[model samples]
Target: MRKIAYSLAMVLLLAACNSESTDKSTAEVQTKQEVVHMEEALLGKWRGMIEIPQSPLEIILNLKELSGSISVPAQGISDFAFESIKYNESDVAITINLGGSLIKIAGKLKNETIEGTFTQNGQSYTITLKAYTETPVTYEKLLIPVAGGELKAALEMPDKGTGELVIIHAGSGPTNKDGNTIGAGSNNSLKMIAENLAEKGIASIRFDKRGIGDNTALIKKEENLTFDLYVEDVKAIVDYAKKDDRFNEIHLLGHSEGALIMTVAAQQNDVASLISIAGIGRPADEVLMEQLSASLPPNLLVESEKALQQLKAGKKVETVSGQLQSLFRPSVQPYMISWLKYDPQHEISNVNVPIIILQGKKDIQVTEKDAENLYAANNHATVHYFDKMNHVLKDVEGDRDQNLASYYNPDLPLTNGLIEEITKFIKQ
Candidate 1:
């Protein structure tokens, strides 16, 4: 009887172990079923915050899973669409082609949460996200009575604490608050500058042109947007800065075309100081001619030479294709032509205020000569040039090809020298 009892006990133990195994298998099968049933609605508008190493920006992904088309909105540019959204279930990957850059996302789904990584320009970053239903939009209409026109302005204060206020005006193109323009092109340099300033307890304000970003309402009326019109806008911001106690002083910092506006605004406003980055000393037309000549290789040098002549003669060159329209547009040409009429050196000479001229030696768009001319014209202005810095104010070196690659890279921080110099000058 004892032997029989022991044998029965061993049999019961084996049955219990099998039952536990079955229960575990059943749980796993249910989990698999739940995962399979969870439809990846990558469709619709997904919104999240992206933290690239250098700075953080808001992201809006308008994705259509079936068509493989996605729209990305960041900075001031909205719904700038891209093609080919490919997915991999095993790696939980999603990728899309953005202009010349490839944007890759590695995502994982757990229960109801979705998280992942995003890589751009050879740099990878962690981006945690969940399925969001609400679409993110960044545009508002505001009235500026001083400017005599209701425009789209970021009326809200900057994320940074107010110490000194820096107002940025974009260059020849429509540098919307987001640093982007349709047809032409936009860079995130302005946004990057704002982020760095925030870290140093400095505040900044940037706006779209009369017609760009939330200002699209104004663009319909073309006559409203003259160079002077833009200057007036800067004045309105400067007035705000002066009246607001948060800003100890207001500094006008312009990039490219905005730089020209700064020279004009500085002459009129009681600005604390002025800074010009990648600004042209000559006219826009002359800069374009010089740029085309410099960008072309030895083999294509002759074609570029003839194209320059056509441009000078007020005729568009057919052979001068491939990114030419981006630099020279009919809408922007008038501004560029008008800009060429005024010399920045003469403008800088008029400013009695202290000035700092920072230029990137490797900036192909605006050469170091442009900065030199401004420095030469102003005997008292402080000048600093970085041989490795590019137009975006990021540290760069080597051939033109490698330098240009930095344009699309979001991971690379803006050159440390630029921030230190500008901050010191503003404080002084």
Candidate 2:
């Protein structure tokens, strides 16, 4: 038997009252311990890879309350459905019967992850599985509407929930709902924030951007996407939360380019508050000039800036130098033109809701000076400069480049006081 009723009640109560203090003390360590679940925490899509000696094998497991499906993408087997799924204590026992052939996997679920031996064809392999914890709240999925179609967002609910809602907008580019992208980059920053907010009894929704991640189909036939479209997408989410009776107030937390979007959206809507993390305080063209100067060679930097100025003057540069083609390429110039119009400080000055500007001192992308400029725009706005925190909101002291390595690390937990500070503000 499992302590279903007891654990559920206790966790919910703890989430409602002592969220920040309790999570600060026990959240990180809990990952190494156990989070016993007697309910449907095990019911969702889980994707991980098995640690083979030479190479890693990818696997996907989709589980319902009692039935499930498993797949080995490399093996050319897709969706081997199974009905014999059993839950016992903290263990998930799955037996897949493929007519004459079978694969048996029994995993121990702990802290939203599963690790166990995978036995198949008289061979055992070590495997670890992490749930697609985007919507870890009631583990609920939120479908948001847009121009032509719907977008997918995950709601990470607080234990008892029924409090405040925060719509998290990730940085620019192709960052997905979980704060990750297609290629080499993987940082679950937004997901971590949602999970952290859950401990503070604050609900949050993070969704994939249009033309990215699962929302790609939403913009399949669309072209020439504008920055205001993103702001509209977020506004739609806020409107959705307004209808739901679970949240008393709605908050916006935006990182990098998202901060600008949230700021513009807040001006048009009645949001409770706004939090800007690693946000730039200048126009997109100015930020790009700074970024290019640091990364590109001196000669190439000059060429990039000259071309950017032309683009900023509402004129298109048909031919870009070879060195700057990757950045000012024709494909992304339309978006850049749309983005360069809004100056951060100017937008921040117009925002109606209270705003908090948070900048990491060690962030190479956006420095503490950016936060200062944002604060300088409105002396009344709250500002926080994290000492050793990086742009990804992780504590990384010493060298700046070495700290950037944490951005690719998916397992690193957020720095201390991040959840604590944000929670205190929203709750207050």
- Cα-based TM-score, every candidate: 0.62, 0.69
**Each model's C-alpha lDDT?**
0.62, 0.73
Residue 375, candidate 2: Cα error in Å is: 0.4
Q: Write the per-residue lDDT of candidate 1 for residues 30-81, one digit (tens) a residue.
A: 1111122224554455555445432333455554443322223322234433
- lDDT of candidate 1 vs native? 0.62
Cα RMSD for candidate 2? 13.6
Clashing pairs in 1: 75-178, 76-178, 171-257, 283-340
State the lDDT of candidate 2 residue by residue for 360-402, as single tens digits.
8878888887888889897558998778788888888778567
Best candidate, TM-score-wise? 2
Assess candidate 1 and give its TM-score to the true structure. Answer: 0.62
Candidate 1 regions exceeding 4 Å error are 1-41, 44-148, 155-163, 178-187, 221-224, 294-333
lDDT of 1 at 119: 72
Which residue pairs in model 2 clash with each other?
137-157
